[model samples]
Target: MKKQALSLLLALSLMSVPALAKENSADNFVRGKTYAGQFSDLPEGHTFYENVAALYEYGLSVGQADGTYGLTAPMTVGQAVIFAGRIRSLYRTGDPEAGPAAFTAAAIGLKDAQRVYAPYLWYLQAEGVLDKALDEQLANVATRAQMAHVLANLLPETVLPPVNDSLITQAYASRRRITDVTEYTPYYNDILKLYRCGISVGSDETGSFLPDSPITRGAAAAMLTRMVDPSLRLTPDWHLPELYSAEGAAYEDLVTAGTYIAAPETAADYDQAVRYMLSQGENTLSLKYDQDFTVSSAQEALNNALLAVKRHCEQGYNNASCSYNAAGTMILKFSSIAGDRTEEYRSETLSAAIAVHDALWQQGTITPASTQREIAWAYYQWIAANCTYDDAGDNTSVSHLPYSLFHNGKAVCDGYTGAYNLLLKLEGIDCYALPNATHIWTVATLDGETVHIDATWGDQGNTGTKQYFAMTPEQSYSLHPWPKENELPQ
Candidate 1:
């Protein structure tokens, strides 16, 4: 049968092309390397590797002089026609080169003599594979969508007819890469045909068919292999690595350790630093600041550190006081008892703050029924009922600490604001100490509004009334004025 097919070519006055491959003893066909160095550029494990190899083995295609298969380079109309005709010839007579002679003979009679694809174009016209009206596109690149339509028309009924649209649609939808094609996609039926015949699989596992994407020569070679033998399969598994910023790992480590560094170089580092401080436990944060850091970054980090300290107290860290510098050098005590002469006195102070917070939580002061404003008011009343105004106060007096208000039931304005902020913070209502030169007060978020609450003033004869409860910034200014009202949260 092969002899008769070869004889038919001679009868057409066709000249024989010399065999390209040479018999060699160099062991040139290495498994990981190219076949006889023909496609040296084709890397192993590529999506089209096996299929292109099969096409080369079947004598349907050859690589360029530089040994590149050009898998991603666009396939011209000439190349597409040659591939289609070669597959047809291979199927009919088991001779892959059988169609080239007929194509060459037909090219000489064409008016467009300068056309490189004229022979393949005329051959396709004679076989009724394509019409002469498409001559203008002879030099244009073949598209994936166009390939789908052409494959549907040329392949056998058994290969082309049984493409289950429903199965293809289900498969297409399951893949993550394909975004353009839907059940309602244009050229929908032809796409189903290509999928059914195994001539095309959407780009990788991502489900991107890229239907309109221009087809490449090496890709065409693989597609041709599938068309000739529908049993051949090409499934691509491509994974792109996840990208991360330079600070991502460091930030993650800080969060995992539950340790805060007050000076971090970047914004990401600053956030992780805050999160580390917030996470519950015995937090021994380094109070040292980097002298070579930006002021805005340093301030933001310091502010967060302070908030973390308050959150620490809110989370029941009464006995443990986190100490840090107030300015660049002057150290100040935050949250814990102040002016304790000995360890025995300091231990007693911690016990008092915990006892007060536990008593409120047990009383359901922060229950679902109570609003943040209502709970805050209750805290103000608690402070008044328990604590007395400490008039004869020194700057380092224990009366200035939250510990004094809870432990001794005697406090200055600092102690009133500190104790009030601590209790309100414990309930998760945002509260902070607002300070002036001589006095301190509390600013809290209540009923979704930032307001001022002066528990000291509310302590009229230690009565603890609603007269000073939940006052707006403007309202509080009338009785007690502060210069930096615009600096607070709106």
Candidate 2:
């Protein structure tokens, strides 16, 4: 047999601890020897094969007499204590068989069948690894939480260093780390200690550690191997999906545009109701009114809401219709431009929008101190330079929303106007979408003056010229007609 080199700490501790246990002990313990036998069940490609092999290689486990590893068998509390004792003994003395002889089965008051675990339990208790209060539960099956408690302190922090502690702390602060494990949970700190040490990554993407669930032998083997081998540790992939922050100026824009509704009384209320429906990635909304409304008024409100949805909301809907009943419930339906939106699809779209917004902000060199006019010009130039006029005469759904301008790099009049309006609102600048019979553009309050900007025309031949930037009403009307009612001062 080849002699394996031990750490200096273990070599030093060997002089203080007692001699190895009897050679005929039930554990059949061996030191400085690697296991050569293979389990019939743990073949190559098995998920637990590598960890179980590591377990055998370190003399932590020898499987069953039947020559098969009971991978799915529930790990008992006694077995957990035994594994913890073995790990501690190996780390402290370089041999799993050595422990203090002052502790024994009779000394711990173990009477009958539980006496089999007495040596390991007494060793752990003597070494401060096992609390005396946990002695009664040694006969039952161990839960994941119990397993964490048993294994958490088996090795010191020097050996089991916390690698993912910061990430875990952040996720826990956000309440996104583990859904089931809370501060009130038993042994919660112990479980988190294991997680920080990379011994266990929760069972799911959400980091859901079903603490009360029984742990199987295969799972135990995986955690046990990671306890000693830092290379086998896993980093958790538990990041939450990003969504538009309610604290951002964009959310205030949504609120101001009447996208969030509590009641449907005023025009803004109805508009916000429709906007809310569209933002939810849904095509239908049933708005219940608190006050009585005439059929024409309800129809007019629906039209206004639809217009607001088209202008303010980034989602694209091709067509819409509404029906009002005597009961004051208006059922509004819309045909989405992007068909069949799932939660995942919505998350992906929002993520893309955020990415585009961040990239544009960085590349445009727009700062908080930048004048509204300068910011507006930056947006105008970036859009004109990057996006092309969608020459396709057919009204595609994307062409009606900013998604076309930012994602596809091409859009018609409304897409350009919508993108501009949204970007201005996100910067806390006041802006509006101005639409004529066949054209749409932007009117913004810049430098205490109202200015007309047409990015679509500015990007003629994909050239971002300043042909229509900072134009007064008089200057813009010659090229694009402005409605008298929606007119603004120069």
Candidate 3:
């Protein structure tokens, strides 16, 4: 209905990308081996978000904050560069119409180019993205992979593939002179990060970064190979191996990280995999569905309390009433673990709580609106829910672990905080979770005001208006922003 909510809904809808006929993953990607999770500014999602949130926070692919990423949007070279400087090495700056060339991040920030770049700020100058003279004007409008391709060009021709038509267009598109290109009105933090990192240089004589245009399979292959190849990235020259055979790696010199044979073979195999996955409907597609759980390190905290309920239930196995209360309570306690960085497991736990609550509601026991607090219930459920002194999951992985309401659950404080923090983020509500007297709760900003959200009390169910607190905007601002992630930096 509202513009923001409408935008949020649209973003949420893009998460589902239909499988493009499966293929042999062996040739394309190594599950845990080939891909490097943590890159540039993003510490890997650690499987915390299946499709959206994982990439969003890391600044790779952002979500609607209402829990949506335009996952299916056919990526354009210009739009893709947003993650260029941060996720990959690359830079683009300069006058779109002068002598264009690439430059390292540091080189472009010369005293003369402080507010603007020179003609040859080449990091991401797509060869023909725009008219040479006007290219420099379109800086900062490229995408991650687009910039990567531009930088890859700096390497010897043998190591780097030819630039694509789309990238060329994107380079030109971004260079359009802004009507009010005043000094100090622009922020090139993203571009600067890439340039300084030596990931890419500026454009050719007419400095520009084409930020529009559709990429082609050939160019995509070249760019993808270079990014994955460790050798190509390590080297700063451009040299493609002599074109010898019809197949095999004609572009091997430009790639260092991959052992991939070629795109045709890989794409074909991928198609097959997609077909197989499709045959099984969407269930087998791991990307399409979430994983179920066992009593892993994740459940160790809540299972202790569930164990008691388990034992009691054994005697009166099918008693619906006992089953509902015991399981429901455990589910609430389990909520503490909602932010386990494992959404699959968290979703499972939430589903259980909802199931129990739904049954109770059907019997006219719990109020309908009361379910609003289920999100909160999941928080404390995982935290203090029957947790023994030290549980494996929280002790080893998470910190500031919260004790459940009645020793009926287990969750490290990290999980609790993450759950609350992410929930607000997913809902597009700006909020921060805080720690006080060994307990955790969140402060949210909405309608120009701050609101306190205490999951512990919220999950406990309510009498009237019980645990939810609303703070004056100023009071809420006192709560610190969410903490950043820890990365094994490069």
Candidate 4:
């Protein structure tokens, strides 16, 4: 079947040679004249019109003889190699037509069926721009991945510098860059190099490269133009809809609040302000008091504000410090539990965590008839079954926050306690996170009795156990030491 298709493709290529030659003849090859507008199919409003115009103006492409650009036509590997070879030649020499004076398929040891593209194949292979493995697939329609391999090394980094390298690196680290491309994909590094050079963004908003899909003429034109003209390359501003919509009624109100606080007088006001900032994924905030205060009074206010933040905000704020500026305004700087993550990354992580929380809530079998103890046990089991302990011991990880447990499925005692407390609060059960010198656990009021639930310890290998659920203070303290008296609620 493949042989039949290749034979048909070769016959078609042979039949189209006369038309292609006429289109590329000296009579039609006018320097600096845009041939893209001449094509009846490619209008100014077309998405690839500018790129095709650039391709034509640079003599890299000439449209079909039928006055159409064949925008959606699948580009063959032969055409791709020819385009790549032309681009290399044009970049090296002032003229696009500059290449080996004479070459043939027989001369390069290629099959006679590839005679139409033999010169281009020989030129590209001699220049080290084309891989010899592609010789067998010259008649096949080039996939996007194959096109990337063909065009990647046409120009050196001097002309095609990787402008979006850091953004691509970050996107890959988060596993959100290209949906279809992975480390195991063929020519994976070449595909990424195209993105870093801004030669291609992707076929969709999610940055899906569609590696198996055939490349279209318009898409090929866009990529070819970008290779020669750096200005035409794209800088990906990844629009992650899933992350944005993951907030899902969990923190919508808090995330939508204003960041500025006009007059924060009481501890409650300060607490609300801090919550607003954290919800908006801010790491720094300036709180100006309506009245003046001495250094000692400001220090007290800062201490109170920190306490309020710790009590009301639990979005993985590890620590915070405040300083009084010359104008007596208090500037607070917070260190996030998701260390070194950008504000956008932190916001997305929080949204993803909220999505997990909402999903678990919807999946739970909780009802009005369910007892408080049963509800607590259900949450404890769910946390234990779903999340594993973070044994990596990375201090900068988000293991200290609920996000690690909800999104990453691995966290420390602090993450387990935070997540458990969050779910219990959603069930209208009063719960608080109790922290000791080294570990943290949840203290919840179940059936009019206060009991400790340590999900971290409850998670024993494959599934969660009730060994630490609904334990008395004596039982819990036997395995895990009790928190300081000052840290415990009266």
Candidate 5:
């Protein structure tokens, strides 16, 4: 399937050759050592990795000789502008290699449009990635900050928003390695957080997040090494030659611990990293069961399970351009890709999962359940009051979990339902984990008919900690709509 997609993309690229004004390269992206890797001229130190690979496979970025990327080459303002424009094009019409046809034609100001590289001005303007810049000095030149803003616009709101103001303006600007605000806001934020943790460093100028200059590949890799495992500074094994540090016990430890398949330092290292992070070690939590264990033990075991689950969730998020917080709200490109799956991301999965064993012990005592509807009445109240009466005309599919939307807790739809199910399971009630077309919801059985219970709606409502659609099994979900052949696993 992967190979087939690549073939299709390559074919598309060929078909697009006539329409595209610029010559395409196969090897432009270089994976950074850190989340934000600056470009470098050197081979090992400067090749673009995953994103580049995807670009090449899709004909966005190609490769160079020696199987390396000239990532270090300075990016021009116009080039960066065009690159960003291409990303916007890919985002809107669903194909960077394809032409614009399915997109809604939005009006753009001619003055700001004139500043963009002519080749991509249309796409950028169409996607709203382009800022009018009409009243600002930047109206003439595109900066890294502007480019980052465009990416931010392309990405899910769950993804980090653009960074503004120099860190020097913040208390940490002096030692902060943050620079250039325009290109990679999330990476910048992650880098900002790390530097605040004393994991990264800074330039000689005023303490600030450059937010404009691109990062170096080597610097990026090193930062990734630090972010994933701070103990890497101490360990000795995971360290690679020349890459590993000695004398620096802290840095050396980073070499001793595990690596990431998700974060492949080298093609050869991908296997080991994946194994260590996914298949083995503490990164993957274990569930221990004792038939005779006390309720406290059970709680501890559950907490452990949750920790592992959180790690998995975080990793899954890392792989995706979208993500969910603990509340299960999702932030992603809802309208374009799969409209908001926030409905599914938050629903009753967790409730059902926990209910699997909540009755096994029947301790005859209460426990704190993490469901969105049970003890967390505050949670329910938040969602109910916050949800907008989703406009029929607004088809932009951006999604936010109930928790996030109301309480800044965000869960996707699945997360919302799963949380409701989880809480109800704790309270000893059977709720409906309903999956609708492109969405999953929950129906708590109400009095006689099943009432539609949406935890996300709960978050948007004004009620306190209670189900937004709570009732008897019949009222919440028993309406008998005659299940479709593919309606959830009901």
Candidate 6:
């Protein structure tokens, strides 16, 4: 095997401390190996031919009748199951360091049964890894994301570490292509786990996981190799900075934007610049600089700060993008709402703010003597009672915005959070919009700690209890996990 130069420190930090049963010095699992083979199509220089050959040598696969490895063919779910069994057998025979464990029966059913792959399918079913119903076309091609799900689940229980142990899910979730994965998908976390486990680093440089794309035969072999080999993948080079710190945030911007900037005259100046940009809200900002203010660093810092501030202003539905020109002028544009931030939207938002304040005040839900819990609970109940959930308007219009809740008296999660958060801020409560994998919710500081307050889930047709309101991290994480747990209060 050829030596693959990579760093593991960052990789280790991104994942949980893996408990490998024993250290195997065998190079079978290591990457960068080459082999001459009978396969006619997979040439020596083909992208993943080495992996395909490795799997073949390991007895995980047999070449086609034509002696060609279908490197670009879409892998079938049944074939994936067979691969899992072959891999388990390889570990059992070659390593000899670990003992076999019992497999639990799967809870879900499988439809079509190919006799050749039946034993492997039954093994996966007993392991509980194949716990969901499969389609009738057992030979149908599987998607790249589906492959991720199956491969991640097939990881040896002993080799697998706890999921999201490094709290990197939020960082992974920020990639531009994540929107490609539909909301509430079954394999959502499994796909993410594939990256965290060092089995895959996504499809491209932009962190485009491209989960729905079909898995190629060669790609499947490479993925299978990486799944068992801990040292085969590269560490993620980027992460979100300490959002509350100006210097940290500035550094993050510089890294992501890949732009150089002249440092501020002093650290104090940089801090002031960041704080000021955040306070500017949704306006085009112009920053004048002294003759010595080259602002090479602050330029990128300013852009990053604007992004964070925009998140706060829009309650985490951050659609605002900003950039600085050579003239030192900073422009902020919100393309998501575009013309929708018209006179109509602003007037309705303002009216909703006033209405929420008046109602809460009149009801005595928030007062100098009221506890944060009481204040938050009252607001959650108020929104639940006043607004009916608009399931169809989820992503159609501005129905998720604050104005929709007041005007239409209907909303999705975003509107429930936006309206409630605005009301809390009016009464001087510190609240923030929190991000789940594909959804958003509200969190607030109350009674010396932060608590989750999801009005959308709490509103159970006006007859439901406030069970979801004021939930602790433990209570809400399973359903609405805050990817950045440390940022939220313990």
Q: Write the per-residue lDDT of candidate 4 for residues 208-231, one digit (tens) a residue.
A: 888888999999999988887767
Give the TM-score (vs. native) of candidate 6: 0.43
Lowest lDDT block of 10, candidate 4: 11-20
The lDDT, on a scale of 0 to 1, for candidate 5 is 0.36
**Full-model lDDT, candidate 4:** 0.68
lDDT scores for all predictions?
Answer: 0.56, 0.67, 0.31, 0.68, 0.36, 0.56
Alpha-carbon runs more than 4 Å astray in model 2: 1-31, 38-46, 62-69, 93-100, 105-108, 118-134, 164-192, 201-213, 234-352, 356-490
Cα displacement (Å) at residue 118, model 3: 80
Residue-wise C-alpha lDDT for candidate 6, range 1-490, written one tens digit per residue: 0111012111101111123322322333332323567578887788786667766544445555446667887778767766765455334434211112222123123222354345555666665666655534446788877787677777554575544334345443333334455456658787777766766666655456777777887888888766666545445544433211122111112111211223333433433443344344323334444334335644554544433333343332335455555554544444335255544574557566666665565454554356778877777777777888887884556766776787788877777777777776655567766755566677777878978777888888764366888888788887766556323222
Worst 10 residues of 3 by lDDT: 313-322
lDDT string for model 2 (51-153, tens) is 8877876667767655766789888887788778767776766556565333443644544445556677888877777687568898799999999989887
Best prediction by lDDT: 4
TM-score of each: 0.38, 0.48, 0.20, 0.47, 0.26, 0.43
Candidate 1 local lDDT, 283-379, one digit each (tens): 3455556444355544555554454443322222223333334453212233344323434443454455546655665555533356788888877
* Tens digit of per-residue lDDT, candidate 3, span 346-436: 3343333334333443443433233334433333343333333224553243323222212234334433443444433322235544544
User: Model 2's lDDT to the true fold?
Assistant: 0.67
lDDT of 5 by residue, 1-490 (tens): 4454344223223112222333222121222223222223333333334333333333343323334434453343444444445444443344453433333133233333333344454555555645554224322443334433433343322222222222222323212223343233634544343333433444434334455566442333333233222332211111122121112121111222334433232323432443344433233322223335455544443332232222222111111233333332322211112225433432322333333223322331222222333333432443454444333312332232223232333456644554444444333344445553445556544333444565654554355334445544454344323334212222
Tell me the number of clashing residue pairs for each predicted model.
6, 1, 116, 0, 126, 5
At residue 170, candidate 5 shows an lDDT of 34
Pick by TM-score: which candidate is best?
A: 2
User: Which parts of model 5 are misplaced by more than 4 Å?
Assistant: 1-42, 45-51, 63-69, 97-116, 134-143, 158-208, 212-490
Better of 1 and 2 by TM-score: 2
